[model samples]
Target chain A: MTPPETETETASGEGGETRTLYGSPEELPEPAREALGDLLLVLADTKRVLGIHYADWILGSPTLEAGIACSAMAQDEWGHGRILYAMLDDFGMDPERLEHERGPSEYRSSELLDEPTDSWPELLALNLLLDTALSVQIEAMRESRLEPLHHKVSKILDEERYHFEHARGWTARMASTDRGREATGEPFREAWRACLRWFGSEEDELASGLAAEGIVDAAPGELRRRWVMRVAPSVAEVEPHLVQETEDGWGSAVDPDWEGWEPRTRRLRDAPGPDDEAILSRVRGDRNRSLLGE
Target chain B: MSDRLVQIERSRPRGEGTMDWSGVAAATRGDRPDLDVPQWDEPAADLAEEARRALYEVPDPEYPISLVDLGLIYDVTADDASGRVEVTMTFTATACPCIDFIRWDVRERIREIPGVSEVSVETVWDPPWTADRITDRGRRLLNRAGVSV
Candidate 1:
């Protein structure tokens, strides 16, 4: 008799096709888990660093209203980072150490999140494009078989709605004004390409492996396509002078500042340390059964 | 030469009175107290003008927003003979993180003036700075940078 096909591949309605093969965290396949872990690290670290960057502007914003909005946004991103890190923590790693100890090079976040917001318009576009894309990604993860991740993803999706709305409102206002349109259009056009680079390669092995294991619901390309479609119409409405396409949106390059930047942090006095080994041991032991699905 | 020395002695300051010690103090100390006090012997000169002229020589490297413009050097009084200058300035913000560094930089540079013997920098936060207080030149720079002043 012919051997049963070990891998399953299928197309989800979101985009081209979601080919599910095998990278589920429950099964504890070494290579698959490693790739998924790296993907999670990138996502988690990006939010963490972006949170810090936004927090720096809390009192420095040009106006009081904007300052409060930015502060709220910073807290939201930090909260998301915490949740994602907790997932990584359950997977045999210390989230606190991973956050403060890693250099920029070790982070997997896209070049988009690294650039300091040089102007208000650039900041608005980035918050719109990047966070909106993240919202969709989190939505997809709602169905993940990794119960903890699925729960965390669902919670994050609810929190990101406000971020998405804020971006849309800011972009709408900027696009409506003559000077705003004149000033922001070119930068928006330029920044979108950097956003595109954030998504991994079309045939990224790590993404595909995660899909195979039913850990991640879709590939980055599918996510990219959905993001483009969702954002292009609104952006076109705002900047009628500009054309919208995958190339215009996704082929742009990253800013040099963000191009090679990474988080540079050290352990804070109150941060978790090696002394928590006993507590970690207990948690790890209790969760090991569900974690490894042994 | 002896005659000239006698004339110089005649021009010296005359003491008002020597410090008096009471009989009780002499009995407690077992000796009388003797005091010597120095006095300004020469006529006071117009040192203020000389100090003002000296201040002109101190380069205000930051232009359009000089020490005067930013109000950093509130008072530039000096004792030219002693060459001591006291400056009163306020920080941009009360919680300014750069306060220590700004004070050090100003003190170091101001001390380089030829006649300056001592420099004191005092930081005050009262009469806080506002955007309207920015000089015309500072306003122009902000406008050029696309910021509304």
Candidate 2:
């Protein structure tokens, strides 16, 4: 079979299939429009950074098919990045400048994008959990009033569902083998910790505003609950040894300082660092260039 | 007294982000006192072609194909005097992560083939590779497997 149209061979696979532009946005809700800029940036950052992570596995994968699968997903993330950037530009922001020139701190992506995956299980968890989380938001975006963003999300969500299925299925298979079960269980715990840091607290204005205006349809915290319900069943089947968290896992999204919790914003603008360029350069330098081509 | 002027720093593998030959060489060959180290007996003319030939000799080791046909070989060049060969290649993508081991495996195999000199294996990104870049042999194999390139 020919490789999927979305896949290609490159160091990063960041240069995947070219994005087709949907029409520009018309009049939008003021709050939604304002939140759209950072929302798109966050999505774009997830694509770009995740693409880098996928590239890191080149040549190091256990098998050829594994490599091909990762490359395909990496390209998908790159394509997703482009789609978000296009939507941003359609909404009146310059995607080219925003993407290539922005700093890491300026990125609105969740913390899951910042951390690197050291093993296949970690990568798998990111796909199953993190991407699944993003997919939840995308489902809501399917009905988004913003035309360009809505159509793009609808297309992307379809593709992303497949990605989630692959990961979930793999997680199921991993449960069969003792080594797979153990190897994955520990990493899943660590990944869950990382996931906890993903969606921001309930009081974040941007998240609240986006949800209030029906831009994202739901806040990340609300989306996370759904995400858990969606993934936990499949994942727990494989690794019954896994520990489950209660609703207190993330606590209430509406609470500003929900007891023993700290508020983390999903907005790239709130990340603890310089802008995208600074982050990208740092990641680039640390990036084991040869690894990218693997 | 040393009569030969060697630019110690420059000649000492000063490049950043690339592997250090000092360590690799030591680990691979230094401890093995009995291992036969290949030597160059001829002048380094047509070094690129020689390196290309050497690289072509390396089978995928994992897959049932040669690196050239598998599309793992990208660019190959040689420095006649230094006997140094710089090869650029790529795997399927960042996700096909086993490439590091493949690259190192290829490098080791190539280096052991009575190589005239050094080997620099790098991963280049410009002019991205596609299935179309695969050789006729690769295409035939793909066809046999019902895979369209």
DockQ for each model: 0.00, 0.02
Measured with C-alpha atoms, the lDDT of residue A154 in candidate 1 is 45
Chain B, model 2, TM-score against the native?
0.61
A1-294 in candidate 2: lDDT tens per residue?
A: 233333223332267643222123435545556666766666677767776677766658767876777777777777677556655655677765665556666555555556556788877777787787677766877655444456455446645666787787778877778888878876776556555545556666766777765566788677767766677776676554343646545232222223332333353333464333434664334446456444
Q: lDDT per residue, candidate 1, B80-110, as tens digits?
A: 7787865555444332333444444455555
What TM-score, computed on C-alpha atoms, does each candidate reach?
Answer: 0.49, 0.52
Among the numbered candidates, top lDDT falls to: 2
Candidate 1 ranges with C-alpha deviation above 4 Å: A1-26, A60-63, A238-294, B1-149
lDDT of each: 0.53, 0.59
Using DockQ as the measure, the top candidate is: 2
Q: What are the per-model numbers of colliding residue pairs?
A: 9, 30
lDDT of 1: 0.53
